[model samples]
Target: MLTLFHSPGACSMGIVFLLEELGVDYTLAAIDLRKGEQNDTAFRQMNPKGKVPTLILDDGTALTEFPAIAYWLCRRHGAAELWPDTIDGQARVLELVEFLVASIHMRGFTFLAMPQKFSADPAAQDSLRALGRREVEAGLATVAAQHGAALCARSRIGIEDAALFYILVWARALGIAVPAPLSAYAEALLARPSAQVALRGLAAG
Candidate 1:
């Protein structure tokens, strides 16, 4: 059985939603980020990156990273609706995924959430946070311009939107305003049975 290491309300929640949508059997292992369970020796043994959303396959093979996990699940389960079929559509999915995970989550949100990683100086930290806010808003605007209308009010949830959902959660936490289109998208996503199950988390087996 697949085992997913995740923290509630974190980026790993996206993977949780994907797993639910796939309707595949999987186990959930909670990692307390606040308590630093990610850095624990046992968890680190499986994933040296010490991050959430680390998927442990049946054979004990560890898969780390969001995009990789999402792709693997969709392919393994024949979830074409979540992934896409055509070359252009696949390319668009990847483009949005990379932008959302790498740019929005890694760079922008990290900056705002953990500015001390960039610099120890208090003055520099302030500037870093400000830069983070700008980066996130600008990145979100790019998303809104490119695909917001298509995704907003959409009944079918794509892989890209799963990625976008987590970012929207962070945006809300940071008190950042998201585009109207994306806001509607978030509502639709959250209302789904998959999302509802994901939010409450799955039972460990």
Candidate 2:
């Protein structure tokens, strides 16, 4: 009885993977970002920020933002192991997820994808993209130090892996070179059955 407002090929796929991991039934509502449907009145009523991965719970408590939604889902479905057992482990996962989402994706990739959002001048946009590359590469080095790719396991894919997965997707699309360990880790996660099904559902939607 949950509903997810998502955009295909967007970071919302991370939430889709979480839903698949939880093995929970939920509605997938497609919002075409190219068409600017997210800014439409109906969706704005749900989430004024007009972002994807908007989750409407059964009781109609709409949730927005990746970290918050992912955390709530993992906690609500504790058996998934998306959440760690100990407080330190949980804190570690939260820290990694926060960095990947807040710093890497929002600050880094967003600039790479839409540099003009930061500035109108072409030269400034190019400079902004260069800065974005530095931010992303630096973040990847931090992730590599943590063995982030290994966060995905045969039994369960931790929320950190899901968070890392989206940024890796953007990196590849933008032609940024991913370090060997994280690249291999992402390929393995893609081979996961849950990821396969989640991707298929998003593509179909």
Give the residue spans of candidate 1 off by over 4 A: 201-205
Model 1 worst lDDT run, 10 consecutive residues: 196-205
Candidate 2, which segments miss by more than 4 Å at Cα?
Answer: 149-155, 200-205
- What's the C-alpha lDDT at position 54 in model 2? 98
Inter-residue clash pairs, candidate 2 = none
Instruction: Give residue 181's lDDT in candidate 2 (0 to 100).
Output: 75
lDDT of each: 0.84, 0.81
What is the per-residue lDDT of model 1 for residues 1-205, given as tens digits with 9 covering 90 to 100? Answer: 9999999878999998888877889999999888999999999999999999999998999999899988888788745566677999899889999999999988898898889978999999999898889999999998988888888645666677668878987787677888878777766777788877777743432
Candidate 1 vs. truth: CA RMSD?
A: 3.4
